[model samples]
Target: MSENLGTMTDFSPDDSVMLKDVLRGLALPQKNIPSLYFYDQRGSELFDAITELPEYYPTRTEIGILERHGAEMAAALGPGVRLIELGSGSALKTELLLGRLEDPAAYVPVEISREHLLAAAARIAADFPDLEVMPVTADFTEPFDLPEPARRRVERNVAFFPGSTIGNFPRGMAADLLAATCREVGAGGAMLIGVDLVKDRATLERAYNDAAGVTAQFNLNLLVRLNRELGADFDVAAFRHQAVWDEDAARIEMRLVSTRAQRVQVAGRPFEFAAGEVLVTEYSHKYTPAVFRSLAEGAGFRVARTWTDPEGLFSVQLLEVPGAAQDSSGGT
Candidate 1:
């Protein structure tokens, strides 16, 4: 890690709280856990691996769009803008935009895993020596403060939430997060986000269930995480990973199915799992351009422009805050 990095937080995660979350999820009628817990240092590495798998099209597709239109996107946002990225894992795709940003004043990456966040921030600071690299260790779903320098050094801000992360949230929660981001970016600012477009079930399911089993590992790693941090006695081999498309919801759901009836103990409490039971781990909702635009508009932003690959597998949209000045065409 680079000590010269602009600012890296020293936020220690609360293990007791994590234990509580795990036990509570296990006790629920339909057991489920927050996806945020899946990013311990090891889990983070597994996720990075998942992104590289050939079956994972979102990462590559989003990167392709950024590489092709980075200059245009940067120019549209204008010069000296403070850039805040939510759930900025690895921040690999961000470098493409950083190169095109016209003297951007600061780069704030908000992430949940402290170790991963700091490591990424260090690398970014080293790569972009002149740009401020501030990493905030917090759940992006909740409100968190940005580094004071990032706010003080620039007048206009743009929250860059790439990777189709907003899809992980339910529709209502997604809107709330977008609205919160609008408040954080404030007036005269904007947001650049990625969204996975609705696609065929076979393709969507395949993406989440790669032949290499990396996605399954990524999902099961949650159990390993619970075992390690929450004292949960979960037999990793007793459950199997599954990914299915919910057509009506236009989403992909990741779950771990129990192979047989089982009982687990976490935080000194026993939890029962019936045969064939499933623990819902994650949901990735796909959206059409119109649906996404409605979401942005509902959150007090105007969809300035949207870019996608020819296949339309993913979308990157630039949303301007209500009062932000824009090109006559409405968006840049």
Candidate 2:
């Protein structure tokens, strides 16, 4: 067991930057906020609770796929691989893959929430004493340096992005992010990602609009974050959470609708909201296998393999860079 806990890159946005982004989003025609803001301590906790709700099936389903096929997935990446996970919330599914990997070089968990990332990283280090745990506190969508393992030599970097979080980005942005990840991992590297599949409208809507209202709290917590962090005077109670399935977009849209006309002040700036005006919070896009393959191909990755549950409601895909030199000893 190595004592090297690994290094952290603190690229977290400052309060001023957050305020600027919040103000900019509020000024948009759609009046949107970045979904990343929903990960404050309370918001993160709320989301963890939402995952346990019966209506939310993605988490459990994805976990089942990882549990059942993690060994195969690990074998695909092979030995001496560096695993970098994006948006590693609690890293609950990560253990399944990490435990199965053969002589993995290191584990890097990238997250925007510093507190959450540190906690998860610490736990992983304590549990996997032989594995180097490098945690980066940054928005994974942005560029950040992958930490070098102090004790081990890695063959290639394999990004482990689970939880269908890639759906949070719009198609174009998602493709761009995938391209960026491909570049970061280099030519021989690969990525293992979880993607939610397009399902019936009822199931999609129910997932976001959980009966327990925990999802609602998770959505509204964005406003709570704005009020607390940016000194925004938002009438949080005056807004209602709404999740709708957009057939044309093949996505679930989460919004906060103002119940009545209201004025809110943030950073001493006033913003007016009409009674029915909506503030877009997030978008979760579901895709068919062909659609996801096309998206990854456009981003410079070839779809190597895909694993899905019996119902095909979600998919865990293995994406690899093409025409790269192979390590003969590594898993194929």
What TM-score, computed on C-alpha atoms, does each candidate reach?
0.94, 0.96
Per-residue CA lDDT of model 1 for 261-322, tens digit only, reads: 99988878988889999999998999999998999899999999999998999999999887
By lDDT, the best candidate is 2
Query: What is candidate 1's TM-score against the reference?
Result: 0.94
Which regions of candidate 1 deviate over 4 angstroms?
Answer: 1-4, 11-13, 150-152, 324-332
* Model 2: per-residue Cα lDDT over 10-46, one tens digit each: 8778898888888999999889999999999888889
* Residue pairs with clashing backbones, model 2: none
lDDT of 2: 0.89
Candidate 1, residue 27: CA error in Å? Answer: 2.4
Please report the TM-score between candidate 2 and the true structure: 0.96
Candidate that scores best on TM-score: 2
